[model samples]
Target: MKTYDAIVIGAGPGGYPCAIRLAQLKQKVLCIEKENVGGVCLNWGCIPSKALISAAHLYEKSQAGAAMGIKVSGVELDANKMQDWKEGIVKKLTGGVGSLLKGNGADVVNGTATVVGPKRVDVTRADGSVEQFEATKAIVIATGSTTIEIPTFKFDGDTIIGAKEAVSLRRIPKRLMVIGGGVIGLELGMVYQAFGAELIVVEALPELLTGVDPDCTKIVERKILKRGGTIHKNAKALGYEKQKDGSVGVKILADGKEQTIVVDTVLVAVGMRPSSKGLGLEKVGVTVDQRGFVPTDKFCRTNVPSIYAIGDVSGPPLLAHKATKEGEIAAEVIAGHKAEKDWVAIPGAIFTDPEIATVGLTEAEAKAKGLEVSIGKFPFSVLGKAMAMNETEGFVKIVADKKTKQVLGVHIVGPEASTMISEASLSLEMAAFLEDLSLTIHPHPTLGESLMEAAAHAMGAAIHIANR
Candidate 1:
């Protein structure tokens, strides 16, 4: 009959934040985790992947440094050492998360908790003991998604692999076939590309980065192509079979015909579906849609009273930041505080070489909605910062409503575009118009100035480039 104010199931980027916030608000909170407290993001997804990518980036930079008047000798790739370094970062981060939760007065229960009722869960401990607890107030589910596997495929976590295995591989594959050219696919492909792998990306879509700006997509493709990598768009992966030599045999349909490609490794980056299974939602009368998303309000309350769900199990965008924000809103709502979440735009970014980041709507989306929009673009080739960095192969584009001058969208494909999109995200959130951005001052000889120039270009007042 033990009870708590709030019980957060899954101590991920979302759940832990909610649990900590609730505890800080003077609530008796219990955070349950089946595996490591930091969950997939800290354990597998973001931190580990980024750690490995950091090594790859530094190596590539050192290689490029030779051309830029910096000399180095005897560079080598140590897969085990790279993995150990990345795992060390994860260990430190997850340990920090555990300490924060405990220090915040949150009870960190190390076990899987299955919902048996609207406000109750059955916890299965590591030692195979079961304990039941009732949540006196709210129950938050933040279980994130897992990698999807194709039918008739064996996931050895080595040769035929997913992002998780691809990140922690001991040896680099000479050639890599990346299936499904989306965010995960492109990210890993670029990682391997930076590590000197011959990469081939296959996508079933007519265009790369569906729902992204076509102009941005074109720039990314051109950059990858210039690097001697191959991309086959509008291609379907039929199936994969083992080769005689134990490499991999991949059957694909591209250029309106069937073909086979042999490679040492295959990284399946199709996509991820929500992990809303085995929690007994139906038994408790909680409604989950066909897509497995637990629908919620702005405050993230579930259909059932005193029940809430956040993060990947909830819905789209599946971003850690989105989940963290949603966790705050849910926590505040349970605490009987006025909490509202309004986003004009949730910017999405692909962390590839010359990263791609976009906020608000794309040109095609605006055109589809039949809005008269003024479009403005500025190439990175004209920027002093890009030239100075010797990476001038992208642009910044702005789309605004022709009538109201409201900034509709901002898209960029260049170095650090992921970090640079934060300004546009805030501007869009404030519903700032093109005039607002045009009037804002931006310091010269920096990457941020491109945004200001693009905004001015949208209003036909740009000073740097010729009239558009």
Candidate 2:
């Protein structure tokens, strides 16, 4: 039997950071992984998807460069080469993770771990070897989630697939049907659409990207429509059939009517479910919820005091950054430091054509809570930078308290929205008032000036745009 101060399962965004931080805190930490070091986020989800999206954006821009007087012909997408490039990035990052863990003095074990007791874990390594380790202090479960595959639209690794396969497709389909209008679906769907695939989106909800700012979603929706994509709201993808000519016929129920849409591929991006099962958590008396989530307190501790859960396995808003933050907090707590999952908000960034980023309370959420709110909006179309970049498609919206002028939320939809959201997140974290944002001098002709201007508009003192 091996003993350690702490043991972390699943060497992912959450687990790796936790193990690294624990080792930094001078704890003897043992990190176990059943797969690659970076987990799904680094290996399959975020990094790979963004690489493909960036390539697609570049391809689209090259074709549209004629308007900018940068005319060139014969631009082609060698998908094999692009895929190779993406894989190179994944390999480098995952390699860095392994190096970081080892450099930080954390022992890395390649195996599948199961909780055998409150402080005991059994790791089944390759070659049918099982090793038992005891966590003298804590055992952390940082296993992430997996994509939910609809029973009817089973993944064939070809025509019908999930996000994992969607990002790795070398052959651009002539027509693609996405079964879900949420973040993953639209982001990847738009990538293929930019690469010349006609897109059809089937969303079960009344609107696309449910729970997001509708105004922001509207702009992306219009862009999809303009690109010759079809959106079927209040729809359900029943199943798919393989056609004789190697095409896929997808059956969908839309607006109480059944319809069949033939396409080359079907990408099911409904959502991801927590990876909480088959870990022997039940045997250790850990409570796995009906939805497969391991409920935890702010300290990331489950019902068992010595056991902790973080990241996608714990709850919703399954973001990699959030998981990393929680991992640090958990490490601090285990090190006898005062740390908890305390933050104003976790900002969300959607990597669409014109990205959408948001933080803090939304306008509808504030109104629903019976709060009187003031809204300020500034369109990117009027910004000089946007015009220069030829990416003027959306706007910045600020929601603030009507009585105190305190900024409640900030939403942006335009180029570099993802990069621009950190300021909004900082404002919320610091509880900045509207004047704090407006009075600050922003550089002239930048997309970020829209935030300052939006704040000014809320106070009816905007310079560039007429007061609302």
RMSD of each: 1.4, 0.8
TM-score of each: 0.97, 0.99
Worst 10 residues of 2 by lDDT: 63-72
How big is the positional error of residue 411 in model 2, measured in Å on the Cα after superposition? 0.8
**Global Cα lDDT for candidate 2:** 0.95
TM-score of 1: 0.97
lDDT of model 2 at residue 272?
96
Kindly list the per-residue Cα lDDT of model 1 for residues 1-468, writing each as its tens digit. Answer: 689999999999889999999998999999999889787789888788777767877888777886688988888988888888888999999999999999999998888789999899999998999999999998999997888888755578878888878878888888899988888888888888878888899999998778788888888788678878989999988887788888888889999999998888999888888888988887898889998889988889889988899988999897888888888888888988988667677888887776899999888888789999998788889999988988887999988899998888999999779888999888888889887887888887888888888888887888889866
Tens digits of per-residue lDDT for model 2 on 1-468? 999999999888999999999999999999999988999999999999999999999999888877789997999989889999999999999999999999999999998899999999999999889999999999999999999998888888999999999889989999999999999999999999999999999999999999889999999999999999999999998887889999988888998999889999999999999999889999889999999999999999999999999999999889999999999999999999999988989999999978999998899999998999999999999999999998999999999999999999999998999999999999999999999999999998789999999999999999999998
lDDT scores of the candidates, listed in order: 0.86, 0.95
Regions of candidate 2 where Cα sits further than 4 Å from its true position = none
CA RMSD (A), model 1: 1.4
Q: In candidate 1, list every pair of residues with a backbone clash.
A: none
